[model samples]
Target: MTELTDRYVWAAVRTVPEPQRSDLEPEIRELIEETVEAHLASGEEPSAAERAALVQLGDPERLAADYADRSLTLIGPRYYLAWMRLLKTLLATVVPIVTAVVFLAQFLGQGEVGAAIGGAVATALSVTVHVGFWTTLVFAILERAGATDAGLEWTPEGLPALPDHSRHGRLPDLVASLVFLGVLAGAVLWQQVRSVVRADDGSVIPLLDPALWSFWLPWFLALIVLEAGFAVRLYLRDWSWAAAVVNLCLALAFAVPAVLLWSEGRLLNPAFLDAVGWDPAAATGGGWTVASIITAVVVLIAAWDVVDGFLKARRASAPVPRHPVLVDH
Candidate 1:
């Protein structure tokens, strides 16, 4: 058979179940070969015959859905609940929080009621569209990829004897983590380009050391990216030893830059302090004290997160007891 024949067969069965694919693939190939052979026998060119056979088979996605005995719908019944839950969660948590932040920032800076309301409305709508679009796109892809079917097969044996709720990572947590990270990264970069804090001389003062942009800031962002990656993995899989280990590594990674910035006493902008009315001497001492406290708090939180991950993973993996049934007295 021609390469086209193989491609056609693969396309048809790509989204079908694994066990079913083994049988369906060969059947599809056989049908295509027969159709192509019959066309060739009628004096059609080889290429033409292959093309005709594939065309007769119809769209690959539809064929796969037919073979799987399911409807070819975007976000079908199997994944519809999951999709709705995620959408509602994002709308409730990330959207409102982001909108509120934007409104407060605009209101505090511009001191205009109408402008703040308009900005907040605009931001809320934008966040909603992006969140809804991407979340739907992902779930749609999962539906087409037959992930829903794989998850739909359930047996009593597959159920955990005692479910560990802590280990069950919710989609909201993942979405929130990603949203918060995006906001944080955006704010960091935004502050650099245009300072939210300004001096009396009309000079813009960024919160962080602008010099750190060349190195330290990138390193800090990289750690945040790593943490985001872990969050995604946790969203996909249950908590485990490997995940906990990586969480600890990430905790340490986050602590390194924080410690360096604190020890070096260059974490915050001196100009920002002056903008806030602190004298030079007080700013120096106060900056160091604040940086030290913030660093300590961040390190402690990271450490606690690592410990929490391990504890949750251990709880998830613990063996559940099977109690014996008592005879009727």
Candidate 2:
């Protein structure tokens, strides 16, 4: 056999059936000697012989790659741009679809057009962030698990039909969708709280407003509960959609207010307080403090999930070495 042919065989064997790794070195060396002997019998000139042999052997990496289908490694790092662009396109496309749906649904029982628009934006944000994140996260985990398989053609049970994912993604996506709904509920509750607590002047009232506070308390607690649920979902589920984006919003929700409240060191806007005849000094500046605390807790939990999810994904994609001994060891 030509030295090239031996290289091809050895490369294929070495690339796959990793449990055979320990055996491959000897087998490859033997193949090399046998091929060289046959070449010498042909009386190929010695000076040109080594060059021909090296050429025939080909590149090791190239040969190893040929043994397996290599669909996994095909995408590579450059595809990240294409990946981001595709999602952006999907989001842009989704926007119009959601708009049309909101417009049509408005006739049935949809709230104000403005509210409908805002709700759609919020829901889209939630689904895109959460569902997509969970999907990606689950796929990543399965992909990592798949790396353990040395056989070129081992079938992973319960793996999703889509490229690079497990079927288990469906459940995670559903849960994320629920989490988005929960966020929507929280926003609604917060909105109610704002309406009841803040006057047109946007200042807090000191006197007990039972009816308002009663409504506000349940809704406020509900928002916190919902955020906790969504955070937990993200922490546990796959990084499906822009799960990070929902997280981004959650982060901003806390960050922006905290900055606005504390950064300026102004509890209430002086002009706003004066117009409402409320003294800014008398007002409890604790609202920002409360919001900041809420945001801090939420951000902390969400950030941990983000970190954990990414680390899991990284482990999934890390370079996997094939070895024959691993099967037994």
Candidate 3:
């Protein structure tokens, strides 16, 4: 009868399919009228009674969904978060490794830069599509089947632990991480153009091997970009087990190659060392000693980084303690 009630009734029934709407409209109107009458009997004003009646009925669209026996979600609430978590984990872990492998294979087989890059990109996109489609389909099936009895039942023990609010990543930490990554990238590129050392002919010599420019340096830079993205993600959200695993993987990605190359004496430019007049074969066993030191530093740093990630995640996920209140007797 009132404008608010009329509008709510129309909104609700309009969403219900055709013939059902005809039956639902009058039934809904009757229910609202009954509620409004009850409120009026309680001494409420007509406008206030009608508004309270509509509020009591809750969201019209949800009511319509119930009347129509319709599901509003594709995957439903039961499996939605699980689906999202699995999808992200697959995309982040499997996709990158697949892309890198494809790129390496294509580049090695064809010896073509552009072709390798294009193929890798295409493969990555295809993999992403398949991953998303399959993941969504599985969750949808589980939702429609009402797979609660299929070992998918939730429990209090299964609930995610709350993060420690005080230990959460700060914006300043993100900024500092991004800045550090930028500086690292800049320093790597800068060494190519300007160097502190020079050859006998007075030509500037880069600190790192020019050979690394073809693959190693670029790959390292890409890992740095991934690290930056991880930092931003950490800043935006609380630390999780997934994030800690990602951090560990990133540390390995960065350190593994660097250690291998440095051990093989492929990391630093030989020309630069010669120009500096520092013989590795000196009495102090300078080259071996320096190489050992660098290797130890790289390994230790990577280990520390991985450990730190796990510790942070553990600390963040630790539950708050509930202390008992004491009353004086």
Candidate 4:
């Protein structure tokens, strides 16, 4: 081989695996020799023939990548669609939940709307960056590893059903409901053991009235679990009169005791209220205003949920229209 051919061979084999380098070098050299000989047969000089051969083989690093089956792009065509599908799925599902959680935590913790919005937006941006970076890293690893399949095999079962107004849209709502219930349960349990508020002596003060833990809190937790199960059943079985009735009962079970407790001034922690200077007796910017607003929101949400459940049930149970057959006379 000429000087150019020698350098070309070295560049091609340098980055390839150690075990492959020995075998690849000879293979590449032989191919280059054959190409050079062909160019000589075609009447080219030795130097020109070698240069032509090297140019035909193109970039040695790219040639090495081809031989090693390594992807040239960050995410190659093989896994590009799958990566995109997963990224979109995660962003759609996770970003909103993260934003909502951050916003609620900030607003509830600090009572500052601007701070809550800013925190939520910042955290969401951070989460998006992290998710994108990690997902790309994983796909890059998989591509380098020469994985033939990325677990995104399509099947008949994956095909969505014919679009229906009620059932098709139910999935996202059900998923959201389940997630919210889970978070609610976690927050309830969290307050029992830890709190952002502390007393004068630095003792933790739970936001909720801890004395109710013996009965009301437990009842609320149980109702939440039942509500989750009901939500699942509603998703699976569509909806029926029985399901709607159960939903109404669950709604009442949650709202009634909650409102009653709030009205009786036994819902929130006295210490927490005192610490925050939120006098329950005050008419505004205080416990009374907050409690009344909360009570109204609770009742309104429950009523809307129950009514929505029945409406969906009615829609799901509606009969489909049949096409009339044409008669041939």
lDDT of 1 at 36: 86
Best by TM-score: 4
Model 1: per-residue Cα lDDT at residue 214: 90
lDDT of 1 by residue, 96-209 (tens): 999999989987997554566678989999999999999999889888777634543445675435433443536777899899888888888888878878777877789888
lDDT of model 3 at position 134: 93
lDDT of 3: 0.82
- How many steric clashes between backbone atoms does each model show? 0, 21, 0, 0
My TM-score estimates for the predictions, one after another, are 0.44, 0.24, 0.45, 0.48
Over the full model, what C-alpha lDDT does candidate 4 score relative to the true structure? 0.83
Q: Judge candidate 3 at residue 278 and give its lDDT.
A: 64
Query: Each candidate's root-mean-square deviation in Å?
Result: 21.4, 20.5, 16.4, 12.8
Task: Flag regions of model 2 displaced more than 4 Å.
Answer: 1-165, 189-292, 319-329
Q: lDDT, candidate 2, residue 153?
A: 32
Local accuracy by lDDT, each model: 0.76, 0.51, 0.82, 0.83
Question: Distance (Å) between predicted and true CA of 197, model 2?
Answer: 5.2
lDDT minimum window of 10 residues, candidate 4: 320-329
> Which parts of model 4 are misplaced by more than 4 Å?
1-169, 285-288, 323-329
* Models sorted by lDDT, best on top: 4, 3, 1, 2
